[model samples]
Target: MSTSLYDADYEALRALLKILRVNAKLTQVQLASAMRVGQSYVSKIERGESFVDVLLFAKWCEACGISPGVALDGLRDQKRPGRAR
Candidate 1:
Protein backbone atom coordinates (compact mmCIF):
# COMPACT_ATOMS: atom_id res chain seq x y z
CA MET A 1 0.00 0.00 0.00
CA SER A 2 1.18 3.46 -0.83
CA THR A 3 0.69 5.18 2.49
CA SER A 4 2.67 7.83 4.29
CA LEU A 5 2.95 8.37 8.04
CA TYR A 6 0.28 11.09 7.75
CA ASP A 7 -2.29 8.61 6.50
CA ALA A 8 -5.07 7.93 8.99
CA ASP A 9 -4.11 4.31 9.66
CA TYR A 10 -0.45 5.18 9.80
CA GLU A 11 -1.24 8.07 12.13
CA ALA A 12 -3.15 5.73 14.41
CA LEU A 13 -0.14 3.44 14.52
CA ARG A 14 2.06 6.39 15.43
CA ALA A 15 -0.34 7.44 18.18
CA LEU A 16 -0.31 3.95 19.64
CA LEU A 17 3.49 3.93 19.60
CA LYS A 18 3.58 7.28 21.36
CA ILE A 19 1.10 6.03 23.94
CA LEU A 20 3.27 2.99 24.56
CA ARG A 21 6.29 5.20 25.05
CA VAL A 22 4.38 7.46 27.46
CA ASN A 23 3.01 4.51 29.41
CA ALA A 24 6.57 3.21 29.73
CA LYS A 25 7.50 6.55 31.34
CA LEU A 26 10.23 7.31 28.87
CA THR A 27 10.95 10.73 27.45
CA GLN A 28 11.54 11.12 23.75
CA VAL A 29 15.21 11.57 24.46
CA GLN A 30 15.23 8.47 26.62
CA LEU A 31 13.60 6.36 23.93
CA ALA A 32 15.96 7.81 21.39
CA SER A 33 18.86 6.87 23.58
CA ALA A 34 17.56 3.33 23.86
CA MET A 35 17.16 3.15 20.12
CA ARG A 36 20.61 4.62 19.62
CA VAL A 37 19.11 7.37 17.53
CA GLY A 38 18.78 11.14 17.77
CA GLN A 39 15.87 12.78 19.56
CA SER A 40 14.71 14.26 16.28
CA TYR A 41 14.34 10.75 14.93
CA VAL A 42 11.99 9.87 17.74
CA SER A 43 10.14 13.15 17.35
CA LYS A 44 9.77 12.64 13.64
CA ILE A 45 8.42 9.15 14.08
CA GLU A 46 5.99 10.17 16.84
CA ARG A 47 4.74 13.16 14.87
CA GLY A 48 4.14 11.02 11.79
CA GLU A 49 6.79 12.88 9.86
CA SER A 50 8.53 9.56 9.22
CA PHE A 51 7.63 5.93 8.63
CA VAL A 52 9.04 2.79 10.23
CA ASP A 53 9.41 -0.62 8.72
CA VAL A 54 8.57 -3.82 10.56
CA LEU A 55 12.11 -4.31 11.87
CA LEU A 56 12.33 -0.78 13.21
CA PHE A 57 8.82 -1.06 14.63
CA ALA A 58 9.83 -4.21 16.47
CA LYS A 59 12.90 -2.52 17.89
CA TRP A 60 10.90 0.54 18.87
CA CYS A 61 8.32 -1.53 20.72
CA GLU A 62 11.01 -3.44 22.56
CA ALA A 63 12.87 -0.25 23.39
CA CYS A 64 9.70 1.09 25.02
CA GLY A 65 9.18 -2.09 27.05
CA ILE A 66 6.28 -3.23 24.93
CA SER A 67 5.99 -6.51 23.08
CA PRO A 68 6.37 -6.24 19.32
CA GLY A 69 3.59 -8.76 18.74
CA VAL A 70 1.22 -6.85 20.98
CA ALA A 71 2.15 -3.57 19.34
CA LEU A 72 1.49 -4.92 15.84
CA ASP A 73 -1.82 -6.37 17.00
CA GLY A 74 -2.81 -2.98 18.39
CA LEU A 75 -1.96 -1.31 15.13
CA ARG A 76 -3.88 -3.97 13.25
CA ASP A 77 -6.96 -3.35 15.35
CA GLN A 78 -6.63 0.36 14.72
CA LYS A 79 -7.18 0.01 10.98
CA ARG A 80 -9.12 3.06 9.87
CA PRO A 81 -12.81 2.65 9.20
CA GLY A 82 -13.87 3.04 5.57
CA ARG A 83 -10.26 2.77 4.50
CA ALA A 84 -9.21 0.13 2.00
CA ARG A 85 -6.87 -2.54 3.18
Candidate 2:
Protein backbone atom coordinates (compact mmCIF):
# COMPACT_ATOMS: atom_id res chain seq x y z
CA MET A 1 0.00 0.00 0.00
CA SER A 2 1.06 3.55 -0.65
CA THR A 3 1.82 5.87 2.24
CA SER A 4 0.05 9.17 2.73
CA LEU A 5 1.36 12.56 3.82
CA TYR A 6 0.08 11.85 7.32
CA ASP A 7 2.17 8.69 7.43
CA ALA A 8 5.23 10.59 8.53
CA ASP A 9 3.27 12.43 11.16
CA TYR A 10 1.75 9.18 12.39
CA GLU A 11 5.10 7.46 12.63
CA ALA A 12 6.58 10.40 14.48
CA LEU A 13 3.66 10.45 16.84
CA ARG A 14 4.06 6.74 17.55
CA ALA A 15 7.75 7.11 18.19
CA LEU A 16 7.17 9.97 20.58
CA LEU A 17 4.56 7.93 22.42
CA LYS A 18 6.97 5.04 22.87
CA ILE A 19 9.76 7.33 23.99
CA LEU A 20 7.55 9.14 26.46
CA ARG A 21 6.20 5.89 27.86
CA VAL A 22 9.67 4.45 28.35
CA ASN A 23 10.98 7.67 29.87
CA ALA A 24 8.08 7.63 32.30
CA LYS A 25 8.71 3.95 33.12
CA LEU A 26 5.17 3.08 32.27
CA THR A 27 4.01 -0.16 30.63
CA GLN A 28 1.48 -0.33 27.83
CA VAL A 29 -1.12 -1.61 30.26
CA GLN A 30 -0.52 1.22 32.67
CA LEU A 31 -0.62 3.81 29.96
CA ALA A 32 -3.73 2.23 28.50
CA SER A 33 -5.45 2.36 31.85
CA ALA A 34 -4.43 5.93 32.30
CA MET A 35 -5.80 6.82 28.91
CA ARG A 36 -8.93 4.76 29.51
CA VAL A 37 -8.16 2.85 26.35
CA GLY A 38 -7.60 -0.82 25.68
CA GLN A 39 -4.07 -2.13 26.01
CA SER A 40 -4.33 -3.32 22.40
CA TYR A 41 -5.13 0.21 21.35
CA VAL A 42 -1.89 1.40 22.89
CA SER A 43 -0.06 -1.43 21.22
CA LYS A 44 -1.52 -0.59 17.83
CA ILE A 45 -0.55 3.03 18.29
CA GLU A 46 2.99 2.08 19.21
CA ARG A 47 3.12 -0.15 16.16
CA GLY A 48 1.88 2.66 13.91
CA GLU A 49 -1.21 0.71 12.90
CA SER A 50 -3.56 3.37 14.18
CA PHE A 51 -4.07 7.07 13.87
CA VAL A 52 -4.59 9.04 17.04
CA ASP A 53 -7.13 11.77 17.41
CA VAL A 54 -5.74 15.08 18.64
CA LEU A 55 -7.93 14.97 21.72
CA LEU A 56 -6.72 11.47 22.49
CA PHE A 57 -3.18 12.62 22.08
CA ALA A 58 -3.85 15.38 24.57
CA LYS A 59 -5.28 12.83 26.97
CA TRP A 60 -2.15 10.71 26.61
CA CYS A 61 0.07 13.68 27.45
CA GLU A 62 -2.06 14.51 30.46
CA ALA A 63 -1.85 10.93 31.66
CA CYS A 64 1.91 11.04 31.37
CA GLY A 65 2.03 14.26 33.36
CA ILE A 66 3.35 16.12 30.34
CA SER A 67 2.06 19.00 28.29
CA PRO A 68 0.62 18.07 24.91
CA GLY A 69 2.81 20.70 23.27
CA VAL A 70 5.90 18.97 24.65
CA ALA A 71 4.82 15.69 23.11
CA LEU A 72 3.97 17.47 19.88
CA ASP A 73 7.41 19.07 19.85
CA GLY A 74 9.04 15.67 20.09
CA LEU A 75 6.90 14.43 17.20
CA ARG A 76 7.85 17.49 15.19
CA ASP A 77 11.52 16.83 15.82
CA GLN A 78 11.15 13.24 14.71
CA LYS A 79 9.40 14.33 11.53
CA ARG A 80 12.62 15.96 10.46
CA PRO A 81 14.60 13.10 8.90
CA GLY A 82 18.16 14.22 9.66
CA ARG A 83 17.21 15.30 13.17
CA ALA A 84 16.02 11.86 14.25
CA ARG A 85 18.49 9.63 16.09
All candidates: CA RMSD (Å): 3.6, 3.1
Look at candidate 2 and tell me the lDDT of residue 19: 82
Give each model a TM-score.
0.85, 0.80
Tens-digit lDDT track of model 2 for 1-85: 8655257656767778788888888999999999999999999888877777889889888888899998787667766778846
Give lDDT: candidate 1, residue 69.
95
Superposed by TM-score, candidate 1 places the C-alpha of residue 51 at a distance from the truth, in angstroms, of 1.0
> Candidate 1 clash total?
0
Cα RMSD for predicted model 1: 3.6
Writing each residue's lDDT as its tens digit, candidate 1 over 1-85 gives 6886578778878888899999999999999899888999989998878887888788789998889999887778667577554
Off by over 4 Å in 1: 80-85
lDDT of 2 at 5: 29
